[model samples]
Target: MKKIITLFAVVVGLFAFSSCTTTDDNFQEDFDTYPYAFEIKNVDLGRVADNEYNLRSTFQFEINDNLRDDETVLIYRLTSTINSNTPVWQLIPRTIYFNNGDLVDYFFDFSKVDFFITARANFNLLNRREYIDDQTFRIVLIPSDLAATMDTNNYLEVMNTLKLSENQVKKVKL
Candidate 1:
């Protein structure tokens, strides 16, 4: 009975000791200093119709960070660039300018927010039957110090981008 009790105690001690050790390689418990980073997400601009003159799609981009006092202003620019300069394409300019690039005050109590943005891409695909399969564009959102400084020609240095989120528009026709 004495020998059996000693073996049981040794086994229990070994098990307890082994379980106490933990590896933190997979996870890091750290806080972010600049916890105000924002991002654009869930952008669902569906397929465009061939004869559809005005392709209006409503979308909202997600901002990652919670509300910070200093990061109150945001200037957004949404535009598309046409690769080919064909005459029919020229009927519609390659650069489709969306915003005037003015800094608008973002009002939110919390740090995180889903900043709602509206984009009216005047996708005039009916102009030419020979349509370009895929047209590309960019959506730029930058922090601005002054509201007046944000314009078509003006933008701040720090910008958060949609990595694989380059807007791909199709020029379709019936």
Candidate 2:
């Protein structure tokens, strides 16, 4: 009788261990979806301060909720349009030197929740509405690891690397 009880206990233990070892078919691998992009069209930059000559605008970037310190924020300007209405995009922190020898710079800064696009120049932009109005910009958020592998200056390359279509990019207005 004691031998039979020992055999029953071993059988139960084996069954329990076998059940634990079985793999679940429903298990799935985790995919990291980090990069995202957006476009703001025909927006005007507001004056940064009462007396300051710098022009600026604020944009809400909700995706930066978990933004790491090393992450990248890329800004681009719609420099012009081509024959088929294709946009010619130029990366920002761009300097435009005027025929008058004055230069204006386009750049931006970002925080966890938002970002500010600013235009600064050696000359006053108060009378230069053309430089501050109807501006279009594209903002891209990327992980530092991914940013390190690509040619950031090439807009089409960046777009392709991120597998982004024009329809995938959300259009925003200010």
* Reference-based TM-score of each model: 0.26, 0.71
Off by over 4 Å in 1: 1-32, 35-42, 45-66, 81-111, 120-153, 156-174
Whole-model lDDT per candidate: 0.31, 0.72
**Tens-digit lDDT track for model 2 on 105-166?**
88777777677777888777776777787888898876576777888889888777666778
Candidate 1, poorest ten consecutive residues by summed lDDT: 158-167
Q: Which ten residues in a row have the lowest lDDT in candidate 2?
A: 22-31
Error of 1 at 31 (Å): 12
Q: What are the runs in model 2 whose C-alpha is more than 4 Å off?
A: 1-35, 49-61
Clashing pairs in 1: 66-111, 66-112, 67-110, 67-111, 67-112, 101-150
Number of the top lDDT candidate:
2
Candidate 1: residue 65 lDDT (0-100): 41
